[model samples]
Target: MSFEASRDKFQAYLTKQGLRVTNQRLAIFDAAFAQKEHFTAEQLLDKARAIDDSVSRATVYRTLPLMTESQILREVDIGSGEKFYLPASGTNSQVAQVVCVDCDKIFEISAPFMEWYGSTVSLKLGLKPITQRLQVSAQCIAQRQTGLCPHRVAK
Candidate 1:
């Protein structure tokens, strides 16, 4: 969807959640949607500040959890000692990365592989699957060295 349409949908969703649309929220959301890369809370605040310096760090932190709760953004831990946020655009969702343990390089996959695995487990367990986010970092040298993903190295 176009950015404007997506923004409108987000605003509507927030309204449904009983949140009054504020300039702060829109600026934060706009900064997020404008960038395609994953962003940390500080990074998000930095971007928001670029657009409107009035946006405070605490506000960004506060708004992020709400956004994640609303499913407009998904939180990801890139194994870099910080969590990052990515927009959940339905089919696009949030892209997870496959990191190279040896070189510390990251690779982005089109779709999350874990969602399928989680679904399978949920069916077997007779439980509903709740996938918060998908993150695959190559922090496992053995897996990468063996040419297998860490989550699939044994197989």
Candidate 2:
């Protein structure tokens, strides 16, 4: 969905939840949607503050769950202590995440077969599937061999 549509949805969700659509929240949303790469809460706070100096770390932390729960963002956990988030594509959820263990870089690849696998496995188990995720952790070959990550933008 377009950012405008998602913004409207987010406002509606906030109203439905009896929450006010505050400026800080909107700044956090803008910062999150502006990211082209996966980011952590701390990183989001910095970005939000850049847009609106009044944006607080606490607000960023609180707003993140709202965005994810509303399906405007996708949460990624790579067995690392910090959680990463990226804007939801709003097209397909059947994507696989490949994380570079050396650099903590994340790459998303479309996995159309996941839909079939989810249905097949759920049918055999007599259960309905709601969602599915496949995450692969890999070491950067370049980093391993040359001691440098070619796509290492992660901290």
Candidate 3:
């Protein structure tokens, strides 16, 4: 959905949860939506602080679950201790994540068959599937051969 729509939804969610639309939260939201790559909570704090220096780490940690639960941010775990967050694509499309073992990079690919596969398995067991996910862990062949991860981003 559009940013305005997402903001509206987030406002509604906060209201429904008896939370206020605080400035810090808005800064965190804007910081999150501004990111193009997956980011950790610490990275989010830095961005939010840049927008509003008063933004606190505790608020960032608390608001993350609210954003994810509100369906505006997609949370990803690459089997690493720290989780990553990215803006939700706002589609019902099935997506599969391919995580690079070498550089800890994540690539999202369309996997339309996930719906079909989930449904098929559910039908066999006489159950309904609420959600499904597919993740693949692989190493970069070029990196393996050259001892360099070309996709690695400097921290």
Candidate 4:
């Protein structure tokens, strides 16, 4: 989505929620949208702070939940046990990720069949499904052979 459209949608959501569209919130939103990959709240804070030093960690943390609730951001668990945020537009109705336990690399898979199955189940249960995520953990041979995974942080 264009920056202006995202900003307008967020502003409208904030107004509907009876919340003020503070500068800090806008900064956080812009920073998040600028990131092309999934990011943790701390990563978002760093990016936001880089854009505007006035942006605080507290503000970013506070705004993240609001953004998720507003459907502007979606929280993802890539098997790291840490909450990662991604643009909701990037992750539509359903997503599936394979996490390499050794390398901590998350590979997203195209699963239209999964979406269809989920929708069918939701319909059978008489419920509406907003979103669904499936995570599978496995080991990658390359990581085991090299003993180094670029994405994995050394403990």
Write down the TM-score of every candidate.
0.71, 0.97, 0.96, 0.84
Query: What residue runs in model 3 are displaced by over 4 Å at the alpha carbon?
Result: none
List candidate 4 stretches off by more than 4 Å.
90-92, 122-130, 153-155
Q: How would the candidate models be sorted by TM-score, starting from the highest?
A: 2, 3, 4, 1
lDDT of 2: 0.93
Once fitted onto the true fold, the runs of candidate 2 whose alpha carbons sit more than 4 angstroms away are none
lDDT string, candidate 4, 8-62, tens digits? 8889999999999998898899899998767789989988988888998888888
Question: Backbone collision count in every prediction?
Answer: 1, 0, 0, 0
lDDT of 2 by residue, 23-85 (tens): 999999999999999999999999999999999888888899999998899999999999999
Using TM-score as the measure, which candidate wins? 2
Roughly what TM-score does model 1 have, to 2 decimal places? 0.71
Q: What do the candidate models score in CA lDDT, each in turn? A: 0.74, 0.93, 0.93, 0.81
Measured with C-alpha atoms, the lDDT of residue 71 in candidate 3 is 92
Error of 4 at 96 (Å): 0.9
Can you write out model 1's per-residue Cα lDDT over 1-155, one digit (the tens) per residue? 56777777778888998888888888999899877856678888989988888899988998898778767787766677877777866776435667655544445677766677778888999998865455564466666468665544221
lDDT of candidate 1? 0.74
In model 2, pairs of residues that clash are none
